[model samples]
Target chain A: MDSIDKKLLNIMQKDFPLSSTPYKDLGEMLGISEEDVINRLGKYKKEGLIRKIGGIFNPRSLGYKSTLVALEVKEGKLEDTASFINRYQEVTHNYQRDHTFNLWFTLIAPSRERIKEIIDSVERLPGVRKCMNLPSVKMFKIGAYFSLDEEGEREEQKSDQ
Target chain B: MISDRDKKIIKHLQEDLPLDSRPFKNIAEKVGMEERELLKRIEEMKEEGMLRRLGAVVHHYQAGFAYNAMGCWRVPQEMIDEAGKKMSCYREVSHVYQRPSHPPHWPYNLFTMIHGHSREDCEGIAESMAEETGISEYTLIYSLREFKKTSMKYF
Candidate 1:
């Protein structure tokens, strides 16, 4: 990503403008045309650099309970266990990690009681030896944002300028 | 806490905004409101803390932050706030949270997602965090595969 692109990513991710012509506002800040900003964002989306451009709601404010869960599964049941855990809509993120208690995922539900119920059901699944539900009591940072200033990255095919 | 109009705007915002120069114009048309009123409503939602922001969600993998690891720390109960506050200051550390850890099986109370351009970079930050916090009991679990990732569509 170029310097300008970095600046765009930085501002766009943190706080985008709320206006009738939002891209025009972004263009004004970046010293570009409205069409240019839109086109660049479109290209970034196509390249998977920009995942999505939209509103991010506060789940806690919307009455949702979320927690990070870790599971120690038998070696042979890794795939089966992970897939079984994935079937639940509440399970948003699931991953295999390099640890003894390998399988981990994040579960979000409408209520804390539902989260506990889901965890209880997960504990009953065969090959699941243990379940650790780490619910967030305090939040320091909400999401990930990479600074654009960093240079010298492996050149992937560039998105349209 | 949201009205029907708020719900309608959310449904539009959750999906991709219309790919046009004046995206709000299309949203206004779909939501049955004036373009100017649509903009004002969005501003109000943000002020009311319903909508966080209108922006691009970068895929770290595609954005050169290829290496990412979760640092679950086992800080003492009393030191939880201090460690969490300190770790949150680090730029690499994202999404720091205080969670209850069941001992004898899991002993991590504070968790942070750390990202880097490389695995070594991630590990280095994790080590520095451990040293800074003075809590050696922790695990840096790097994500091996992304089974699913998406924003919640509550609207």
Candidate 2:
């Protein structure tokens, strides 16, 4: 990415404009026209540099209880089971790691029962093994700022308003 | 330049905060207000700190910065800020904050997350951190799976 692209990414990652014409407003700040901003962002999207542009919700405020559950899937069926678990909209992130409990994902549910239900759903998936739930008893920190600038300081950000 | 319609706009914007062009226009239609009025309220809310940001919270795994671990440090009260500052500066380190370390109960005084493309990469970052900070007493709790990753809501 060019300097302008990096600068734009930095700005967009933190505080995207919520205005009706955010591109126009952002262009004004960046000393470019609104059309240019849109075209550049469109290119970024096409290049897969930007996965999606949208409001990231604070799940806790929306009344969903979440937890980080870890499990070991049958060695060969990891990918299949991962795809199965990823089907749920509530399954925000899923990944494979190098450890005894290899597969990890985050699950948010409307209630404790729903959390159990989802776990059972995954447990029933082919290539089953062992599972464990490590729910966050306390949250030390959540949102973090990634300032691309080399000299930027790290900020321990509050998750939401 | 505030109006009742603007308040409605602000109310909706505080929720979901769509990722789309002309989001304010979308919100304006929902809140029964003109797009310009909605825009003004958003600008004001951002200025007032009621709205922190509106942007893409990407799927970290897909980005290839996937390897992650919960690192714990027995940070002294006096040096947490110094240590946290050092750890948080690394792009690989995402969340760095202080938590009370209660002995005979909980031992980790400071917690931070490190992300990378592979286990070796994550450990390499951790090793460098240990060397740079001279922090020998640390444990790397690698995440075996990512069960969930979402933000909390503020009512």
Candidate 3:
């Protein structure tokens, strides 16, 4: 990707405009046409440079009670336990770590009772030995944007902004 | 450059972008605003760092780049910025961040993510990262399956 592409990516990752002619408006700013913007974005997606380009909202804002859950399963059942936990739509991301409590995932439910219900269901799965949930006490979230082009004092730049 | 009206325009846009030929006109009609007004608000948001371009959100596995793993490194508190900066440079590294590590419970300090076509591809990135950081003890947590990918709603 070129400098322009990198800039486009950096901007898009944080806040993608929700507009019908967003590309057309974006093209106007970049001195390109809407067709060019569409083509470039298509190419970027094809290249795996971006995971997704859609609405990214705060889960809490949507009234979902979410928490990060960690679990340790017996040997040889990692795959099975992980799949079982992931089968629920409430589980957003599930990963197998190297620690004793190997499996960790985030779960979001419409209510606290529903979350407990789901957690209980996950615990019932065979080979699941232990489970714990750690909800974020406080969020210092910066919304995950890497300014690849900006080479110096990025944190400072953000604070200044 | 963005005002309250611009924010409202985005709130409407998030529901769904019109899929027709005259999408802007369609959006304008729905939002009870003129096309020019809606277009102007979008332009301001872009300038103000509030909105990027609109586009399609792809399903990675559907497209066949399915090997995605979250690799965490145990960087000392002093080296987090250095490690995060280093990890951010790699093209393979998509997401990089620093999360609190509670040892005897949670040991990994720095988190970096890489998505590839296969497990071997992800392993390659992990091995390379190990060599780069000179940290022998780390974790490569691969996703066994994806349950949800929907973005949370703002409104």
lDDT of 3: 0.64
Candidate 3 chain B least-lDDT 10 residues: B146-155
The TM-scores, one per candidate, come to 0.89, 0.68, 0.59
Give the higher-TM-score candidate: 1 or 2. 1
lDDT of 1 by residue, B1-155 (tens): 66788789888987877657788889889999999999888888778777766778788787777888888888888898889888877877767888888987777888888877788988898899989989898888887767667777774
Best by DockQ: 1
DockQ order of candidates, best first?
A: 1, 2, 3
Q: After superposition, how far is residue A70 of candidate 3 from its true place, in Å?
A: 3.1
Q: Which tens-of-lDDT digit does each residue in B1-155 have in candidate 3?
A: 33556546666755545433356777778778988877777666555555433444444554344566778678776767666776666666666656666676667767777765578988887888778867657877766544335443332
What lDDT score is found at residue B61 in candidate 1?
A: 80
TM-score (C-alpha) between model 2 and the true structure: 0.68
TM-score of chain A of 3: 0.85
Best by lDDT: 1
Once fitted onto the true fold, the runs of candidate 3 whose alpha carbons sit more than 4 angstroms away are A1-53, A57-68, A73-103, A107-161, B1-11, B44-53
* Pairs that collide, model 1: none
By summed lDDT, the worst window of 10 consecutive residues in model 1 chain B runs over B146-155
Model 3: how far is B90 from its true place, Å?
A: 0.9
